[model samples]
Target: MKQIFTFLILGLGVCSGVQAQVDAVQKLDAVILSDSKLKNYAAGIKIEKLTDSVLSNNATSLTNLLAFNSNIYFKENGAGMVSSPSFRGTTASQTAVIWNGININSQLNGQTDFNTVNTSNYSSIDIRSGGGSVQYGSGSIGGSIHLNNDLKFSNHAETRIKTGYGSFNSKNLGINSSFGSEAWTANIGVDYVDSDNDYKYLGTDSVNENGEFHNLNMNVNLGVFISDKDILKLYHQSYIGERNFSGTLVGPSRSKYEDENFRSMLEWSRIIGKFSSRLKVVHLHEMFKYFENKDKDNYSLGKVNTLLINHSFNVSFNEKLQFKTILEYSNSKGNGDSFKEPVRNVFSTTALLNHKPNNSISYGVNLRQDFTTGGERPFVFSVDAGFDLFEHYQIQINGSKNYRIPTFNDLYWQPGGNLDLVPESSYQIDLGQNFNYPNFNVKLNGYYINTEDMIQWQPNSTGLWSPINIGEVASYGAEVEVKSHYNINEHQFNVSGHYSYTVSEDLETNKQLIYVPFHKGNLALAYNYKAVTVFYQHMFNGDVFTTADNLEGRFTSLNGYDVGNIGCNYTFFKNTKNELETGITLKNIFNEVYENVAFRPMPNRNFNIQINYKF
Candidate 1:
């Protein structure tokens, strides 16, 4: 270990010689896609943007991308395995995942597995924290995450290749290329990763075996400039993977899983008079296979297919007022070993009005209605306003009504299915304040949410669990974020931190909700000198309860823990149009023994190093 550290240091030091001869590399140009329709109508909303740097990091999956914000928490069984995220104090099903302007939640469970999402597939990511059902459809009571690929029309061609080696015999490789002509552009990307995640745990002296995974992803994008006012774009992506499940210390089970997913979309936009219109068609297919070596009866297989057609138009009425309307239609079908075959069709319409009467004030209102083939109809609305009090101070507020429909599993699972279940609905509000300075920025936001007709599974007189809609919850939270930057000659420094406090309680029993943390915080510092950059990050998670009763302190309790990480990057070679870069990251510097999910132990200290070349 000591020799490896010495070699890494020597390698970085040898590359420093080029700092004196090379000029600073220019930043990549930001690509603008037509998918910014939702962002343009939002006021007093908190949105976090994750660039390529945050997406393509040492972390194994998308879980790490959401963890960068203290307000969102991801519960993972372990590295390279199943993971889910909770926003504010809402459940995983309440958080929506939007891929290229379309909701991609599973029809079976109404949830998206973070482990199956590869960050290398997308060029940009955006997270909106609050209810967004007014613009999006159901299953957005908590928040929404958007992954988009930008279609860049450039004059030059570029290619990049990246590879990484890490602990537990982990390996990753990716290739991306783009070429453009006068009126046509094309881009393609491919990524592959495999890992033998047999890391040791605290309770067991021997390393946990049967923890392996393999993944592959490919994407293609094509864009055509139909004149100067009209554009057409097409995208396609596919993912295939297999994983072995690693059970907890108390009970170990031998099982393996396989998954295949494919998605495609076509979009066309045109500018007519003062109105801009866009039309999109999307298709998604997913399949999963589960095998239990010891018990074949417990094995299962399932698949789902979905198609969507959507259209929207934005009209700029002068510069102070704008109106946008959207119409969407969706069809979904699910089939499985135990699930009853079900097909659902849904249609929705939305209208938004925005007004910016003055330079310091802006406001927006939204109204939407959804109709489903099952005869379930829902109506939602939102209102938001923003005020710039002074040059350095600003205030904003927003309120919305949201809803989440029952999943196929909740309504069609053999013995536990309940066809009489109703949709869950929520009312939420948010208030925020911001202070900006030349070198620093500070933001604080507080929110409250109340939900009714919540669904849960409970055992009946027959001693079998069945879905029921007899639950209610009240959730509230506050978040704070601060950022600062400094520069001295050739050296640059950046500091940022965030803290959150949340409370969720059941209205019936007045008991604290399970799995929701009351406190979370993060702090990070970064320094850049010439061609080298270094960063240190720290995180703290409050204790969580596995059961609503909070049983024994050692049994049902998941104690809080603190973790630290340090990393560095170096640009070894650079020219006008080409560059070579390498970096290393060390996680859990102190080797803390902790678990995000009860009974599931996380790995100890780990290290990963990556290299990239672009030309």
Candidate 2:
């Protein structure tokens, strides 16, 4: 399609999959919540063998809590929808979100936005910020979000059902059921959602453009306990969507787009006294089709398939000694009628050590290497440590040497894009402190990243933009978060907020990076009574943006606020064998109009209600 050999001259080797997650198995470094490290802990964030379903009615959005005072430098585009989730001045794609343990992102291609992912399917989501390579894997120069899910459990039956409708014609319906027995456990669930999102803009005759989003998700997990020391599982998940992206509520009828993805995993684990081993194989397929306009008459579509397999081991000799190792392999085939025949393989390995020398201190470090058949073969490494000082005080320090290989899209995004790009490499460091007191908690963190071979859509003297790696970048930022949870008789309340600020600049030209906010964050206060809760959400933004230089001073930013949400739940029936639950959600309660992202207009206040019964 486009000259595909440009980056080949620099990166060519038998690349591998991600290395293993090596952590101390010794009692000293062993961290457990509830029971069963792989089962319960996984439900919280670990990702391998989790517990509950996150999409249940009792669950909330991933950003629900973090949005309050957490984003510093978030930019809102003209049309309104929070353009995408950017962190510390980075674009959406810069922040990698992993579903399960594998990365679903299209390399540096930057296709799917963070918002495209509904945290609804996960049992819990873990966020690792600031070049956290050791904890995650590669492409984490910015940060990472990991989604944990529940595997099929035995001898239990549970069903979840919910329905809700709120402002701007938004509504959701979900039903999921799970069954487990001694020999096998099976789980199946489905979700349906539709939204007619429309919000008014400030100082404009045009209401923010709106997009109707329709989504469907299906997943199944089957597992068997082969023996007292061994277990095997099969996991399958799929998602489909029809999205409108014209930055308008009602555009050309044919303008909406569609996306479909499916994934399957087979895993086995064995335990013997102080040693354990695990193996997993995965297969994934994805397709994306979009229109140049709503007409749907003409569209450009693409598809990709990936097969990845991984193995790892852990051993503990005593309360202080532990060892771990991992290896993986992957093959990706990208073929689209309108694209190229991109094929490649990767290999990876990692080693780590974790120590809790005392009750007041804990730390860890790791070494990693990645090799790809037709891509860059970079050796990366990371180290981190967290200390609980004295009492109620925590301090964390982390750093990493990581690289992000350029994706095919960066060099081949069509007509005028460049295909001759170099991979980006960076070094990052972060330090943070936290204090927890009975009912109050506070956390403060500072981070910095220095990058070489930075990716850019540079404008040429002729005024056209082309992807290039001819620049360097430096990013520095700080975040402060505070939370208070207290109960007054029948009333309970949680007040939480965060303040984030980032300054990112190009080292080569001394200019600000594109589409990054200089300051952003949110504040939320929720009050609850028996079966009732009311929430007040406020989001704030500071000045910063990106656009054609021709509109130097024409850009508009948020120095504004948006009020969101109000809801209540009611229990109509309760018995040992039967129960009924109902609730409602009011979004944008005050009807205040605002946008968190550029070009995406969120609906004004809305309402939703749900009812559930058990037999």
Candidate 3:
């Protein structure tokens, strides 16, 4: 506790220092993604942006980056294993993942594995909290994560290469290159990662064997400016991964997983008078294979393919009133050993209106409807308002309706498939406030979500599992964040912290939900002098119940744990067009023993060193 206070005091001193000598430090232009409807219409939404420096610190995977800095909780089975995120006390399937303006959640399970996404492949990441189904489509009852790739036209060519080594025989290598002119731009990036993951188990002498994985990723982007009124952009990404799944201490040890993912998107934008229009086409394919043992004959294969076409138009009437309309068409097909061959078609439309009477106040309203040939049809809507009360203080209120459709596994499983399950729906409300200053920013938000007719797989009297829409849940949470940064002479200091409290319950049984923590907190501080920098971060997760009934005298309760990490970076060389940097990170400084998921132990203290060069 004393260390935390001292840290805050040091940051406060920097924030209170004189600003006359701060002209030497320049802030980079933040990449503000325009794909979010909330960002364009509302003023005080709960949105967070991860900058380039932060991304560089944790470039291995998106799971590692978000688990430490964000309020979302990630459940991991083991090192280099499958990982998923739970947002705002909602289940994993309720959160949506959008890549380059298209939904990329798996058609089989309705969720994306964060461990499979490489953070180094994208230039920008944005997280928008609260329900966003009105604009982003279904499966957004909690929030949405948006990943973007950019192609900027510049006169100079640049190249970057990095290599790193860590504990458990882990290796990382990456390369990125970009060069373009005013009329055309292009970017290419590639990354490779492999790990043995043979760490020792806590309180035991036995080592976790057969826990190895390898991953490769590639991304390409091109942009063309066809006159001043029109532009076109194309993007492609591919991923290949193979991993050995480590079962429990007493379970099988030879299971393996292999997967391949490919995505392509093309977007065209035009401007005419006060109207702006954009058209996008996307295609995605995923292939997965599972092996029960080392035997080549014992395996299963699954495949899913999806295509999307979307069009959007925005018109501004003067500066106080604006209107936007969007249309989306999608088709999906899947085939697997346990699933029946299924095809689905969907069409959705949305209309939104924004009103800003003055600079201090703003409001927005939107209505959306979705039509599906093989699924439930529903209507969604949202309303939000914001008011600037003072020079740096603001208040915001939002309400929305959201829903999620059953996945392919839930509807088309071979043994107990149920094609009559309807969609799960929810109503959400959010209230928030913000305080912003040159060197300080603070935000507080509270949200309540009431869900009805949730789909769940339950065994009948005959012991056949089937998905049924017979569950209700009520989830509410509060989030608070504070950040400060200052540049004093040649030294810079930054501090950021957040805390969240959530309570999720089963409406019928009045019991807490499983795997949802009640309290979570994070703190981070960084200092930079000249070309050298140092940082430290700490995270805390509260106790969680692993069973829905909250029964005691069982092994279904998980105790909370604390984790701390410290790192330092230094510039080795710098020139007109060349630079080199070296960094080292020490994670789990305390060597804490804990499990995020039942019976899945995490790694202990480990260190990694990285070297990067750019020319």
For this target, which candidate reaches the highest lDDT against the unseen true structure?
Answer: 3
lDDT tens digits by residue: candidate 3, 58-119 = 87779878877788888888878988787998888899998877778888888898999999
Q: Tell me the tens digit of each residue's lDDT in model 1 across 1-615.
A: 433533443343333233312433232222447466557887678777764555655344677666754468778887778888878888888999988888888888888888888887787788888899988788898888888888787786988888899899989998999889757788899989999998888656866567889999999998887766567889898999999888887777688888888999998876545566678999999888888863455668888888998877666667889877777889989998868588889887777889999999999998887878875688888999889999999898999999999988888888798989899999999999989899998989999999998877889998999988877899899999888889999999888788889888898888767788899888878898989989887888889988878664887879888888889999998887798999998988889888988888888889889898899
Question: Residue 221 CA error for candidate 3 (Å)?
Answer: 1.0
Runs of candidate 2 with Cα error greater than 4 angstroms are 1-83, 152-154, 181-184, 198-210, 247-254, 416-419, 461-464, 548-552, 556-560, 573-579, 596-600, 612-615
TM-score, ranked from best to worst: 3, 1, 2
lDDT of 2 by residue, 269-367 (tens): 655666666678989888878776776477777777889987666555555545555666788878764456677677776555566566666666566
Angstrom error at residue 494, model 3: 1.0
Higher-lDDT candidate among 2 and 3? 3
Backbone N/Cα/C clashes per model: 0, 49, 0
Worst 10 residues of 1 by lDDT: 20-29
Q: Score candidate 3 by lDDT.
A: 0.83
TM-score of each: 0.92, 0.84, 0.93
How many pairs of residues in model 2 come into backbone collision? Answer: 49
In terms of lDDT, which candidate is stronger, 1 or 3? 3
lDDT of each: 0.81, 0.61, 0.83
